[model samples]
Target: MARFTIGYRTVKTALGAAVSIFLAQLLQLDFFVSAGIITILCISITKRDSLKISGERIVACLIGLLYATLIFELLGYHAVSIAILFLLFIPSAVSVGAKKGIVTSAVLILHVYTVGEASAALWINELALLGIGIGVALIMNLYMPNAERDLLWDQVKVEDCFRTIWKEYAKYLKEGDSSWDGKEITTASTLLSDGKSKALRNIDNHYLRYDDYFYHYFAMREKQFDVLESILPFISTFGDTVIQGEKMAEFMEELSEAVSPGNTAGYFLIRLDELREEIKEMPLPQTREEFEVRSGLFYILHELEEYLTIKKMFKPDPKRTHNVSGKRLTRDLNKKGSKK
Candidate 1:
């Protein structure tokens, strides 16, 4: 029964409609039921979207009312007049970017036609109806419980998938031949895509436009995923595990464990610089196969540097930052060493 039950959004829409109808009646507006219908149309999954769309609907309704009045006054109410009104008003509404409100606009036009006249009183009543409906929808959508927490959970899921992928990369580097199924890469991609979509919806739940931290965070992760994908082909080029390869494997393992919010990439960046110097000091390759391996290792190192730089450039929300303390960092490093 719980699975079959209607959602909270549906309940909110129903409540909004009821309130709109009651308000319309209290004000003694004609076509009071139209207010309820408008309320239903205005209800959206998010408050910001609801407000935006309602404003458009109101504008479209007015345009529709104007066109209907002019057409009806010029050519008395008839089937031909209704057809002509649609032909003209639909294009006019589209031109003004109020195409979304066409259905509601049609309702207003038909209302005017049904009464055979467009009087001042009728106009006032319709305006009142639009106001009550849109206003009620705005009020109902103002509160969204657990929205932030839900977004955080999505963020954590995406990060966990990233950690798993990095761990697999580490194994591939250490063994030179890995049994990794590549499932985690697909999983991370899916999670990032889904998380981004949800964050965009969450952005629409607020009135202010630019404070959508999760949206930006997911976008950054999406960019990093491209770098991760590039590294996979380079990983498969390994002929044999050399000393530098083992060091990179260790670095990847450490990186996987450090994948948390507010974790700094400065330590990893310094370690990468040291690794680059060590490669520079190593003996030059003599054979063609040795040269290919050395060149591939340098390319892999360059990509790894880029991967860390992306994280270094990312700035997480200050309020949400759970800064990894020195004590926590020590503990995490110890745990990774113990696992190895």
Candidate 2:
């Protein structure tokens, strides 16, 4: 029973459908009508995908039913007609419905069951199953919205769209981590996309109102996207130079870690604020090529390290900062606070 419950989305769906089915007959509608409603409720969208899948399926099923009905009327309800219908009707309807297998199934079932005005029992059963399938799918989606899971791989692919630039950054930096290689960037993109999508999709479920939760979730994702965009070109140039002189790149990475934004060490932030002042005094590179191509990466790192340093000042490290740095530092960490 446990395995069976895990194997299919049946347990919850069955319970839902049974309750709906009972409600259907109780409402004086036929068993099929109740089942159909149940199915629709089950397969409804819980994520941000819109009714794209459900709409597609409904359309394909209707087309298949219509096509089957026409063929049966014109050619008679013979075995050959069913077979012919399978060939022409299935493919034709499926093409319109984007050729999704489930869509095709809905269409085929509707088509065959409604042929020649079948017994009411057959119609009821067919409608019930269709409704159950759709309803169950939707219910499952809404409760735990798989927007995160569904878009993960695709998001990874989209992030790779910026990979050429990042590779250049890594090359310029001359010191790359194979683990944090081009692939991990791709993976991070995917995770962010999935997370964002899931966050958006949780709007309609009958469970917790994740609308607020998702809002913050996607907002973070959007910030990550912006950060990656800003750093891409710089990383490319930095990586390329780092590769040219490995030791300097290593030193730079170490320097970065020493003052990284996540750390409690004040050295990175202080050095960066000082370096930003130095960049102001330095002469400009002669050309765009010189600016991007010939310039050393330490300068860029210094600028970034400086910016991160400033950003870090407000970020409190709770573990080490067990004792407060007075009210000033606490208020400073609050970016929105109106502190002079």
Candidate 3:
């Protein structure tokens, strides 16, 4: 039953089409069925997209009306004239970036050809029908209730994928195992890419320009994912799980747990600084192999620091402030320390 349930968009499209048909009939417009068809074509998943498409459709209809009127007046609505009309009309529409309107424009041109004349009254009827259809679709799509919720869900899914990848990296570091499947790396990359795309679509669904925080947030995460991929090869080159490796593994485990919206990466940055100082105090690498491994670890650490810095520096929108209170987060950590 859940799987079979229809979405709000389907219901809205049906209702809008019905309204357009009824309005066209009431107005006694010629080719009244076009109103219903146009409504169906214009109704999209998002309000902004619906409006954009409807505007394009209207412009395309006007182009078709102009072309059909000129051709019918000159060639007298014959079959060959209709063919010539299409050859000229299609190119003009495509040249003006109204290629999406090709089908709807064809319908409008055919309405004139079928009537055997290019009368002004018929043009008025077609324009009225277009208005009824596009207006109804715009009205129906004015509200989208689930866009923000869906964006949030995508954000969480992307963060979860990132957590999994970092946890896998921790496992590889602690074990120094070459047998890691590396599947989560690919999975995380795909998830981030998809998440960013969905977030952009969600942004376009809204009317306001200010509701783009999720899009920016996903973009930042995408940059961090690139850094994570760079760190993977460094982690894979370890010969043994030394003390420094174990410390980094522990840090990664902590980081994986902390990967969520609204959480600051300040604590992680501080811990990284401490770890860097600790590494400096350790004895220098004794062999060429040891130096190479040590240098790789340092490079990985530097990249991780950059990744955390990107998150730490991000300023979320004030109106859409989903961030947890820094003081409250610090207090919660303190309480955990006390309990320990």
Please give each candidate's TM-score: 0.88, 0.43, 0.84
Ranked by TM-score from best down, the candidates are: 1, 3, 2
Local distance difference test, each candidate: 0.81, 0.48, 0.80
Per-residue lDDT, model 2, residue 118, is 41
In model 1, pairs of residues that clash are none
Number of clashes recorded per candidate: 0, 30, 0
Model 2 error, position 315 (Å):
20
lDDT of 2 by residue, 1-340 (tens): 3453342334545565665566555645433454544354434445333245656565665565666667776887777776776688667756685454344455445445445554455445455555555555565555443443333333333333333333434444574443444554565566566656555555544343443444343444345445555655555544333443343344344443332113443665555566555644556667675566335444455445544444444543343232322233334444433551
Give residue 119's lDDT in candidate 3 (0 to 100).
89
Q: Residue 163 in candidate 3 has what lDDT? A: 75
Q: Candidate 2, after superposition: displacement of residue 298 in Å?
A: 6.1
Clashing pairs in 3: none
Off by over 4 Å in 1: 1-5, 26-28, 242-244, 323-340
Cα lDDT tens digits, model 1, 1-340, are 3577788889998998999999999988888998999989988888778887888898899999999889999998999999999999999988988988899888878889989989998888788888888889888888665466656666666777778888888887777657778887888898789878888888887676656788888888888888889888877877474544777778888888787767467898898899888877888988887687688778878887887788888888888665553345446556765896
Candidate 3 per-residue lDDT, tens place, 108-176, comes to 889998998888899899899889988998998886765665565556566667777788888888876
